[model samples]
Target: MLFRQFFDAESSTYTYLLASGRGREAVIIDPVKEQAQQYLTAIEQMDLKLVRAIDTHTHADHITALGDLRAATQCVTLMGEFTQAECVSDHVREDDIVDVDGIRLRALYTPGHTNESFSFVLQPERPEAVFTGDVLLIRGTGRTDFQGGDPHRSWDSITNKLFRLPEETIVWPAHDYKGWTASSIAEEKAHNPRLAGKTEAEYVDIMNNLNLPDPKMMDIAVPANLACGRG
Candidate 1:
């Protein structure tokens, strides 16, 4: 498979592009509006056709490129079935397979960071990697203080859903701040300070007491994202 990971420094967000190979159909996940042209350039250079753009959930930290990409490429915009982003052209329910030129992504409803959050497993038949959109991070987890976020649900989603993937499965989270690019399921299960060796109750306590401030762009980003970034 051909895979590319892009970073938007402003929001500490990560966008992903995947295709079976050059000139094949491709899909993008969690794209940032400011970086749309960058992605388009890469897609054009690779001779790939952009067919789908997906957001795991409505974002509060950065505007999405979904609408822009669709306008430019005529690709379908997608989100999880529970999302309120009505502008999305399609919604994938749990276990729904998105097949693009032999590259497949199986949607997994692992809501926690936000009630509509989802994680897409790549090559689901063998489970090579998972695009965990903010629910599971490298050595950290998304704060569960708003947007229908719940500490208990986050714990359940990570422990019961994500942890069940193969130990070697690559974890590609939506954002990372510490310069870490990727992690394996085994590494997170063993070393994640918040989840590793901690009881559910303890995990909940930690998340509840985080007292983190809301994202600087939440007020603007949330409303804009609902319109597929055109608001």
Candidate 2:
């Protein structure tokens, strides 16, 4: 298993590259549209075959490179199974195992940031990690204020699903507010400042009280993303 993490400073989003050590086949997760060359160069230099480009959900930060990657490498495009299918060639389901050459990731549908969101668990000695799209972040969680974002649903997913994971499991979130990298479930439970032992009503109350603005890139990203990168 080979892995690399790329952070786009502008949006604070993290892109991950996971390649199969055996066959050199790779998958790109949440790539930035502005940096197609970076993604291509990395794969090209290693002589790896690009198989899939996946977005944990429709992004509110930046346009994704799925279409660009497909045009260049002919890789399959993937997203949450609940999202509209036109954009996602592969609709990933909960517990569905995605095999990329030698690396196999077990999918866990963790919907909080969005009803369609998912978190992937990479197996083996359990590297004790999961790629959490927007649900569980270093200091905060994704806002439940958009099209598919619901405060109640988010509370359920975090408390019932995500928080139930091993306390030691490391979390790689989609974006970090303060430029942090990874965090542990134990750390979040102890200091998340949001979930803790609060009731769902309290969680919703807090979210309702926040007059947060929409993501800067949402106006451009949503339409284009839904059209599968025609934007």
Candidate 3:
């Protein structure tokens, strides 16, 4: 397998590119518009064709590269079925499989950072990794304060849905502010301050009382992302 992780320092966003191997079809997740050229360069250098570009949810922090990548490579743009981003060329339902050049990701509807959020499990037949957009993070969880967010749902999604995956499945979150790279299901379950030993009520309380400020780009990013970054 061929994989690359790109970081957008400006937004603390992590973009992922994956392929079965060089010269094969590929997919990208949570791409940042500002880094479109960088992804293109890597794709070209690897002799891979970009077949799919996916956004796990409508991000409020940064504009997406979906539109740019599609225009550049004619790739299909995708999001979960519940997304309001009609600009996406395709939508996957829960348990739907996304296969590109032998790499498969099973879509999981795990909303609550946003009502429309979705996470993808790589090689779902025997899970290897999970791309958790914002619902589940390395050590903390996403803020359930806007975009139809709810603390109760966040708790349910993380504990009941994500935590059920294989303990060793690698966790790849969309954003990380403290320079941490990645974590595993077992690691998060064992040490995550927000979820480790907390009950559902306690988890909900934590999410509800985060008291964090909105992303600086929310005002612009949300609208732009709804249009697949062309807004």
Candidate 4:
């Protein structure tokens, strides 16, 4: 399998490129608009066809490259079924399988940061990799103070959905502000300050009191992302 992780310093966002092999169909996840050209270059260099561009949910921090990639490569634009993005070509639900060549990812509706937030778990053969988009971060969790966010729901999603994965499952989050790249289910369960030993109520209280400020680009990014980042 071919995998590449790209970082955008401005938003601390991580974009992922996945393909079974060179010259084959590929998929990109949580792409940033400014990095569209970079993604195109990588695809061209690998001699691969971009078959799909997926966003876990509507983003409030950075514009997505889904629309741009679709325009350039004719790839299908996808989002979770509950997303408000009207321009996506596909709306995936829980358990839905997204495939590109020999690679497959099963959609897991792990809503927390946003109502439509989702995490993609690599299929049966590679159950060890999970793309946790903004829902889980290294040592911390996504703030649930806005965008229809509910602290209780966030706690439930973490303890029930994500925690069910095997201990060794690799966690690749959408954003990481601490210069950390990846983590494991085991590591997070044992060390994540947000979830380690807290009960549901305690976790809810912690999230509710975070008092985090809104993202700097929320005003522009949210509106643009609702249109699939066409702006």
Give RMSD to native, each candidate: 0.5, 1.7, 0.5, 0.9
After aligning candidate 3 to the native by TM-score, how far in Å is the CA of 138 from where it should be?
A: 0.5
Error in Å for residue 150 of model 4: 1.0
Query: Which of 1 and 4 is the better model by TM-score?
Result: 1
Clashing pairs in 4: none
Candidate 2: global Cα-lDDT? Answer: 0.82
Q: What are the runs in model 1 whose C-alpha is more than 4 Å off?
A: none
Query: How displaced is residue 215 in candidate 1, in Å?
Result: 0.2
- How would the candidate models be sorted by lDDT, starting from the highest? 1, 3, 4, 2
**TM-scores across all candidates?**
0.99, 0.93, 0.99, 0.98
User: What TM-score number comes out for model 2?
Assistant: 0.93
TM accuracy, model 3: 0.99
Candidate 3 residue-wise lDDT, 1-231, digit = tens: 999999999999999999999999999999999999999999999999999999999999999999999999999999999999989999999999999989999999998999999999999999999999999998989999999998888888888989999999999999999999899999999999999999998988888888999999999999999999987
Q: Give the lowest summed-lDDT range of ten residues in model 1.
A: 103-112
Task: List candidate 4 segments past 4 Å from native.
Answer: none
Q: What is the lDDT of every predicted structure here?
A: 0.96, 0.82, 0.96, 0.91
Clashing pairs in 2: none
Which lDDT tens digits does candidate 4 get at residues 1-231?
Answer: 999999999999999999999999999999999999999999999999999999987889999999999999999999999988888999898989998897999999988899889999986465868999988888999888888777888888888988888889999999999899999999999999989998888888899899888999999999999888896
